[model samples]
Target: MAKNTSGRGQRELRVKVKTARGRKLSSTLWLERQLNDPYVQRAKREGYRGRAAFKIEEIDDKFRFLVPGARVVDLGCAPGGWLQIAVPRINALGEKSGKRMGRIIGIDLQEVEPVPGAEIHVLDFLEDDADDKVKGWLDGKADLVMSDMAAASSGHKQTDHLRIMALCEAAAYFAFDVLEEGGTFVAKVLAGGAEGDLQKVLKQKFTKVAYMKPGASRSDSSEKFVVATGFRG
Candidate 1:
């Protein structure tokens, strides 16, 4: 953040990126946006891995899914920001006296520095029997299964949309297998016409399927989250 007293009494100014020889214009623009984003600053001060943590915080604030004693599985849980948000809300630390302690398991293809109070695993969730493995770790089935995964962007808007929708669909299917009856499933997705089929499938498996763009998500981003609850088993 910057200040410009020359204009008004004391106007707050957005941090601007100075062009550097080695940096691409796109990279510079992204850096400047990050510097100006309040959520990013809050994440740094609050000790969360990234601003993405607040997206889940806002969602759970409305839906109240991260209740005490809930068992949660995070797919592609790299960096573990969502796990950090879930830990305290779900009471995973047993610090909330008289509340049931929750359990959180996070899985990714690559290992992550463990979030305290979360079980981190390096298994790929899409491979055969992956659901069984997660269930074993949970000692049965999970109460919630969530993902914040997105495929590498191909730069083409339509292609990127289809790719992320595929990932969200896969995560939903995995949730179907691992979640106990009446559980919840949440995952990030890009808003585009290609999501219809995925929405149809989720509606079949879960009693309520809704979409939301949390306030923490950038207004310019097409990203949104699908929150399906009351899994029918």
Candidate 2:
């Protein structure tokens, strides 16, 4: 059994992990952090798929974009956490009386186990005519197009940053093609020098563009979310 290292109580308890012989130090550290993360515990208790759900929840709560009847597209929605959050907030189940039902469409390179009220597809959003396919599934334009996609890490920080930026730019273009006028685009991005170009493009197309690092994000991480609302086109 693991012991609490930060003093035990309802509010202050931290789990400590001892390194195992076969585990790399980095892996051990990650496991320890997961065990100690309050968001992880909260997610489990609240029946969410993972901690990343809170990041999107916080963003949507502040921005007021995931309303009832809004159509949403979630890019690279793996492990189905974001989908779980979206279903209830968007009233996809028609459980919210008097509110119109919403739609959720998610796509990824790999197959995701179905999320109850969401339509999850296995497709790379960057491929040819992918935007058309997504629109076909939704049957119309989306009110919001969001992405939590990050490229596979190359063990080189700068290289990884550029790759993710490229992915974000691609998602932005897809949003441009399929979003309704006054729509929204939300995506995760790393804080690096190369993001200026992406920001420029977003500013041109959106009435308001804001950057946020949600409280659920780690303090040491450079990841931030770019929320461009009030789409001009």
Candidate 3:
């Protein structure tokens, strides 16, 4: 039923989903892909909300920005997988003796189920006064401002790309206003031609801007993450 990639020479098993009377072909294909995805299986075994958790986990592992005591703000943090990973990594629970306690704030347009050690609010990050409100929640600037938000797909590929790029750009500016100097900004963006301006702005505002597609991300997906560190603000 599932592929095992644990051993070096093990054969991978691919699961096939047959379309049913009520299910669309696209839905069946998606289901099959999810069923065979190693990351999805790993998430279930590890008790994570979803596979997207590994994307942030791998990225933070390479960058090491989610250190103990770091104050993090997650934009559009729904389902709370990122929040769950951030809690322990950042020492938000104060369970790590001798480590400074960390804090995290999450905001989404819809109400999300609670994740221990994270403060989640039902608010849209794109609102005009959202940055100010976030600062109020954090009691100061944040050491990290990360986003995993993507616009609702319109089925038009180019239009979807533009929409995500715009959302990423807005998140960048919001980070500029609320991130601490020498902090980090991370967000997901679809690979498309319209990201030039977004990259340019991040370069101007951050000491280093790096792009990566974590191993947990689906290979066929165009999604990539932008990690901008050392915020000028």
Candidate 4:
């Protein structure tokens, strides 16, 4: 079951969504969970595009990778939430006084609405030439490459786990190509038996690798983030 908010001066009367005549129970349950989720409400109140913005927010809060003057690349950057968070933190718009300006490029398979102070591209990061293209766009190697990509769910747990691990590994290899020496890579992955291989691979390339589950993530979710820093390039 999903958690709900309470306490004085906060929300009351948890929203209950009755199933429509043709709706599936899963759909009804999902709607109810979204309505009750505190992070979703906070996203609306704080002007983030979605709750996922907070995941990166929490991740970067600890890693401190989104510093001013850092050049960043965001793979699978749909809806532009990560870009929105990176812009100000990286000083993409030069809003911070006496801080170095930063640059970020976001790529996705679908066209995303433009986020101010960031560049967005419709691209698939798996293409053979994708790394070259991103290099061309950035005009230099990136200081950090991050991803929020996940494979489409097939409703089978093991298959889903393997699929996401494979995607995360691909993102890691892509990072190896475009990241500058000592850069960072952050990505999402599921917890499963096969992740040991992914960890082994990252350990070879990064000086430090750590995992974190942000508070914004649902307690029931299997998702966690891998933050690999000090790219050995």
Give all candidates' CA lDDT scores. Answer: 0.94, 0.94, 0.94, 0.95
Report residue 27 deviation for candidate 1 (angstroms).
0.6
Query: Which candidate has the highest lDDT of all?
Result: 4
Question: In model 4, which range of ten residues has the least summed lDDT?
Answer: 2-11
Q: Which stretches of candidate 4 lie over 4 Å from their true place?
A: 1-11
Q: Candidate 2 residues 1-233, lDDT tens each?
A: 98768655647667789999999999999999999999999999998889999999999889989999999999999988999999999999999999999999999989898999999999988788999999999999999999999899998989999999999999999999999999999999999888999999999999999999999998998899999999999
lDDT (Cα, tens digit) per residue for candidate 4, span 1-233: 85555565464668999999999999999999999889998999999889999999999999899999999999999888899999999999999999999999999999999999899999889999999999999999999999998899999999999999999999999999999999999999999888999999999999999999999888998999999999999
Model 4: residue 194 alpha-carbon error in angstroms: 1.1
Please write out the lDDT profile of model 3 over residues 12-64, one tens digit for every residue.
77878888999999999889989998998898999999999999999999999
Positional deviation of residue 211's Cα in model 4 after best superposition, in angstroms: 0.4
Over 4 Å off in model 1, which ranges? 1-11
TM-score of 4: 0.95
- Which residue pairs does candidate 2 place in steric collision? none
- What's the TM-score of every candidate structure? 0.95, 0.94, 0.94, 0.95
Candidate 2, run of 10 with poorest lDDT = 6-15
Ranking, TM-score, top scorer first: 4, 1, 2, 3
> How many Å off is the CA of 183 in candidate 4?
0.3
